[model samples]
Target: MPAQPFTALAIGEAIRRGELDPVALTRQCLTRATDSDAVFISLTEQRALVEAEACAQRQRSGTLRGPLDGVPLAWKDLFDIAGTATTAGGKVLGKTPAERDAEAVRHTAGAGMVCIGKTNLTEIAYSGLGLNPHYGTPHHTPPPTSSEHEHESRNENEPRAPGGSSSGSAVAVAQGIVPAAIGTDTAGSLRVPAAFNGLVSYRPSQARHSRLGVTPLADSLDTIGVIASTLEDCLAIDDTMRGSAPLVRAAAVPEQSVIVLDAGCLDDPRVSRAVGDNLEACASRLKDAGFHIVRRRVASVADTLEAITRHGWLGAAEAYTEYRALLEGPDAEAMDPRVRKRLEAARQMPPDSVVSLYRLRQALKTRLREELAGATLLTPTVAHVAPLLAPLEADPEHFSEVNLATLRLSMVASLLDSPAVALPSGRDDDRQHTSLQLSGPCGEDEALLRVALGASSALTA
Candidate 1:
């Protein structure tokens, strides 16, 4: 039988064993990109080909670099990719190229990965829904066909948003075109799409993954996260992205205890049900395996809820700063009306209000640590599945009202500075995927990824 598609560890081993050539792998990804929805805004085909051939030569010469040598990754457009334009999904950025890839991309390069190209994103990474009239939304597809499983027919009008910012990255991995991709998160950007695509995603604790080449959304809240097919695959990529390599993520999750949050702030009934069901199932599995599973309603539930409110730091403040110049340009007519309105709200916020939001953020971070006491907290990634864009388009007021509800729990993981991972919960009656969220202390990315290992299989199965 032919080998399974790339997983970071699998690909690394294949490279070491002389069974896979980086050049061949890069070409394969480039071919896939060409036939797909044109989801990538720009392709680094020439450069990636050059790097992959070099890696192939290095392997034969017995000078193998570290793991991920010659592996391919689809970069979210916000990250500078050396020669590609860093147009965080805006018409204004044009084709002005970068001199070098972002620090995280450089780190991945150091590990021997080839950059295939830049993926599509939300307009300025503002909206949760992945609909981009600017670049193009990648189709949210289920895993490829197999004879045994019954598949749902595509509903072109029902609703399909691949979940923003990381939209193309998630779609690429889910459709089996790539093994892994990188995306940035401020307000649930990375995890949302991972859930939508039924893949695994990891959001490192703030600054845990390097931010040197990433265009700033909210510097304090910005985190570079990975979207991959599995937990172990994500871990392999995360280790390569971090500044200092960790021996293991064990210290962050300690063998001691795990807690499940009574996180009911989610507005979508389908999302709430999927999370509740999966959390119970995960808790039972952990207990049966001799892991201490604690059921606790955390005190910071209110603070977690507050993180999604309009006045929060990553919300209005960051959006306002990101678009200050663009909002004045002639092309402002091309901007999404709703996105434009949100950024405009940021301008009205008092300077003092932004400061207070940061202070509250610090307080919330401390609150989560004390509440968790070095234990892990698990919940659902979103309050609901992706809502129909028609409803938002038809009832603008309703969209504004419910956006907070969808992001409620995720914003907590971001605001509290905890490392978080979104595991797939089973699909709903509608067959839309749901994600169960697990969070760890300030820098516990690896631990969150590990704990999520066993349960993620349930999301679609």
Candidate 2:
């Protein structure tokens, strides 16, 4: 009603229809950026202006690029923007600017999307918690900038977290400051934040989007993903970010054949409640929408999680080795200690174990396609809603327990080498939702997105 927040596609169309000026939009975006302390890390104000002007000129000439032409978006700071050095959430990456943008940024720009700035992220994009000590953590969208100043959260007693590692990107979109944002998901960086921020997001298959110039966490599982206001917006960003022009595949069947995960492994009461409630509601919607929903056991549900544990995350180990030099300095001491400790796990993991993990990953991927055909596997994006920050930060055990649960379901996609996307199911006791993950066989990015689209649409309905 009040300038509907989930309308990035309409925003793009408004620009196309000449009802909005790209330059003015960029200026407003930059103005918002100025006061978005802690929410945004870098402002591409000057560059955004240049691009916006060009888009406006093209509009005047009636040569506008495409759907997202003149639209403004932000990249998670983990991405390397052209002429902006990627700090990757660490101060050690000093004043050096990137010579070129990451492949997704370049593609998005080529499609006429303007980069407002880089959003904040977890240091080295490690934690799903989005806690960064080097660069500040990105908080969730605050109350509106109005004289009334309605406190958005309603409960002062409840602390907030935006989720990670794409924390600021989600905050940016959720706050109505950006149409969409980009972030990487080696695990659930894109999905976690989206769920926490109550926005639409998708992590397409691992290699669906190019990884060139994106700092890698796990070479095999790392993927560039998007956060937007709608499923269409997610699909559009996907199209713009691909090398071969990503296409959303049509449904193999008119309805989703789903396996409702009955795994008892989810011990967290809060997480189980959020996930269980949503699954029940979603199953009902799918049935009403003419999709077949069934409560059935998904094979390898627990085994896959066990595999990820045995793997100890090949990506984490490799990422630690990749950034070993930068993480060794005095700057490392200043980083969020939790983040530093997480990276230390990488150093301790044997390379041989990492190799073993990759083999397991490939095998599990085969299991998805070969063993489970004509069905989609559903799991909670996070075991719980975004927790109060202090407990996780102050208590190592708390952080460990939360991190394990958050990543437990997400790591399945990495282990299986399947394409997984997290969809916001519905609000629960926390007035928010646990992200629901849908994973498909290898290279089924399109199918995964379509399923996510159906789920997201149903939730809003």
State residue 260's C-alpha deviation in candidate 1, in Å.
3.1
Name the weakest run of 10 consecutive residues (lDDT summed) in model 1: 245-254
In candidate 2, how many Å is residue 344 off?
1.7
Clashing pairs in 2: 82-100, 82-101, 84-98, 85-97, 85-98, 381-435
Candidate 1 — what's its lDDT? 0.73
Off-target runs (Cα >4 Å) in candidate 1 are 1-5, 143-159, 243-255, 263-271, 307-314, 350-352, 388-402, 444-461
Model 2: weakest 10-residue lDDT segment is 142-151
Q: What's the distance in Å from true for residue 291, model 1?
A: 2.6
Local lDDT at 191 for model 1: 92
Clashing pairs in 1: 69-112, 70-112, 102-213, 425-459
lDDT of 1 by residue, 29-125 (tens): 8988888794788888898899899899889998877767878888988888777789888776646889987888888888778888888887778
